[model samples]
Target: MKFSRLLAVLALAAGLSGTGASGAGAAERVRVGILKFGTVAWEMDVVRANKLDAANGVAVETVDLASPDAARIAFQAGEVDTIVSDVLWAARLRAEGKPVVYVPFSAAEGSVMVASGAPIRSVGDLKAKKIGVAGGPLDKGWLLLQAYAKKTAGLDLAREAEPVYGAPPLLQQKLESGELDAALIYWNFAARLEAKGFRELVSVEGAARGLGAEGQVALIGYVFRQDFADAHPDLVKGFVAASRAAKALLAGQDAEWTRIRPIMRADDDATFAALKRRFVEGVPSRPIAEEARDAAGLYAQIAAIGGERLVGPAKTLPDGTYWQGK
Candidate 1:
């Protein structure tokens, strides 16, 4: 009889332990990685506006990643479940075996290279002059600039000029101080410097003319791990719902400017207005022909600049490279 009583106590203890574990697991949250860029704010608002996490029974978390390389590394290490960044990194990641699915569009380019004092007026004039790009050989900005040089002016960027790599803030400062001849700059930063007399040397729009700007897309996108997507299908759908709503909200004047001003580094309304006019708006559809072509053009530039040295075939990005979610 005593042994029977001990058995009942052991069973009760096991049941209590199981119940405690289940409660803890239920309260756990999921971690998401993100950048502080403009689109991220839109996403944050949308998620809240739609109450996605609450509806889906999952808590959304965000980590601020400094660079594309760092984001890629984190995603590969499984530290993050999703990210918002350039699709170029996605293609490269899939090619390297750390696979992730492209979810939806993020920010479009109001990004370009600006020259101080207007020494370089057009794309052709960049020959033999130093150009500032973000990454060295692997930078999409460098590839775009090089392709523009080659296709528009027939100048070979690989041998003809010097390409400098630095952070956007530092590069823009150098451009303003006249330390660098030209620097790849976004619309917001470039507008702030325009008050100081910096001018557009070339644009992402112009590059679309020769570099598949219309047919090939180059905008940023939101990406999620395929396994995560599969495991949490309902949660993924909620995220999509939130992003679509954010894109709609971004189409409005008051909504966009209200969000953009705080993110603008320059402390001026005129700069914010100029950037809003010249850079933001029109988040575009997933299958942007010009953007896709620009992406392909980048691949071609990579091919010319020893892409095969890194990955073989060195051809333009084929179909299925981007995922628009199922």
Candidate 2:
């Protein structure tokens, strides 16, 4: 199994696909691009462990890549059938005349992490302090923070905080090393930091709620091109069912966690527990229509601050962005 996964990674990196897109059979393979250490792989592990794919009449393959960029590249090159991305990207793609569709994955978002004893208590306290931000200047979480601050605190975090942008790991390290006053990082990294005694000053989810977004917004999801879905509609729908089943297993059973702990790379029991709890907390439970409504609202809030370059070409979410389980 290990050898095969390694080969899959190599094939993904080389833009080679072992699966065919011919869609002549229900068992025709469906390859999903995954980041090697991403949380998405955890759910995929659950799916395989439970044989959910076989139950749903789909043959699933996972292509591991070193980074999100690599995963997107592999997917775009037709080396993988789907990638776990966000509705924002799908909206952007639709605006560009490519009709990508989204399947609800997780509402899990990032947070602002400060030292446990750091003086910063709210967005207002971030003024003139150095902040380590992941996902660059146009990151949705960072932009949401800015919008939330402007609406509630009458301050723009992007302008007030000395913005230091880097990858999630780099930001995590800097926050731990005291080189940063606060770090806005993805949820998994935030979970690790929280386990290490870092404090969450503000969560992106809380900020979105403060901005009047309804329901739990599934910010990220399994995204694929519509043309690809047309090729294997059953496979696509089956993958969704398999994903839902996997989420149910992960959310309800501790037994599954015991099996997948090693893949999580958690250094301590606290980290392991944190990752498990946060991941389950992110499971999408709201109806797709409700989540889509919230996502559209959240998009406008971020776009008002992030503009076209960050929010993408769509001024609003394009129609048919959500798969709606059809």
Clashing pairs in 2: none
Residue by residue across 1-326, what tens digits does model 1's lDDT show?
00000000000122111111112224324445656564464455454444444444434555666666776776777776666766656566666565666654644443445545466777777777777765456555566667777877898775787777777778787877777777776545666666666677666545644665544254567777667666766556555554555455555546655754665554666766665554334355544444555666656665566575534442556455555443
lDDT of each: 0.56, 0.80
Model 2 misplaced regions, further than 4 Å? 1-26
User: What is the TM-score of candidate 1?
Assistant: 0.76
Model 1 alpha-carbon drift over 4 Å, by segment: 1-30, 37-39, 49-59, 110-112, 115-117, 253-256, 286-301, 304-319, 324-326
RMSD of each: 11.1, 5.3
Instruction: Estimate the TM-score of every prediction.
Output: 0.76, 0.91
Q: What lDDT is obtained when candidate 2 is compared to the true structure?
A: 0.80
